[model samples]
Target: MPLCLDPNGNRCSYWPQDAHFVWEKNGQKIETCVSEQTHVLADGRVHVLTWIKDAVVQDSQYCCLVSSKAGNKMSTSYISVEGSNNQDSWSRGFASWKSIISEHDKLMTNWKKTWESCNKKDIV
Candidate 1:
């Protein structure tokens, strides 16, 4: 996390713009309530990031993405948000939920075929 100083050289915080900060959970976007997010220096080096406002420890994803047309690339960092409450465990478990609909459809299709093949009229 980056920290700045006030006019009196007192320590302060900084927040990254919307383009740089993204927070999500279970593939759903979450509120990025933060006092300070990113602090970029003169040389374009991201010194520090502060995310402290309305931030709770849970199974969520935080990403810091930077892209440029010069080459076009991205970077990200993962930090597991764990809470003592242990409330968002079962509902949001997967670290990465990939193609959920496709996976569910496949499972349902197989289950449907099995159910149809077990016709009650032909039951042994």
Candidate 2:
């Protein structure tokens, strides 16, 4: 049996077809063979439609663990500059959001790479 994502946003069952499974992103569906349909939490992350009942049951603890791991992997650098003139300070403040966004993008890229590496498997 193989686990599949539900395409229609409904509950479904999943069975392990082999030693490997597919990686589905958010807003995507997977089909599986498990009889009970429940929300799935994977790797301490909450998934919208997960077939693993245990994943749903342990979501809270898993979520905390995941958050801690994410926090550990993130690096933040903040620089505060006091300008002699108001205009200079205003300009620096306005540009701060861009730096924040760039940092977020870096974190996202790193997380994606980590996920891909962990989920790599050969299907027979």
Candidate 3:
């Protein structure tokens, strides 16, 4: 699945060629849910509605487990950060420029105030 991130956030999931040189064929599976008590099961299947709020880096692995009377299997996939990189990069650049401009404006205002105060003879 593709992971979504806000603009200006450097948290990207770029696929590193070196990282995948060695990987396990089958990995452990994890369940996604809030709590067992909150889980709703119908017809031997679990159905739940939940929202996950957090931040994750690109290429983060997510695993899921499938179980049955026959046997159990595991599946894993990585989140793609390319989706947010380009878009967020531009946004972050703009935000950085804005911060710089704000700082410049504050410096100029202080300089002007100091200049005016010095002109009045009371300023030493």
Q: Which candidate is the best by lDDT?
A: 1
What is candidate 3's local distance difference test score? 0.47
Inter-residue clash pairs, candidate 3: 13-58
Winning candidate number (TM-score): 3
lDDT (10s digit) by residue, model 3, range 7-77: 43432333211221112212422233322212223332323222323255543665544343445555566
lDDT of 2 by residue, 1-124 (tens): 2244455543343322232223222323334442333344443322333232333211122111112212322222222334434766667877997899999999999998887877785322
TM-score of 1: 0.29
* TM-score for each model: 0.29, 0.26, 0.34
> Which of 2 and 3 is ahead in lDDT?
3
* Candidate 2 regions with alpha-carbon error over 4 angstroms: 1-86, 122-124
**What order do you get sorting by lDDT, best first?**
1, 3, 2
Q: Is candidate 1 or candidate 3 better by TM-score?
A: 3
Give residue 42's error in model 1 in angstroms: 9.1
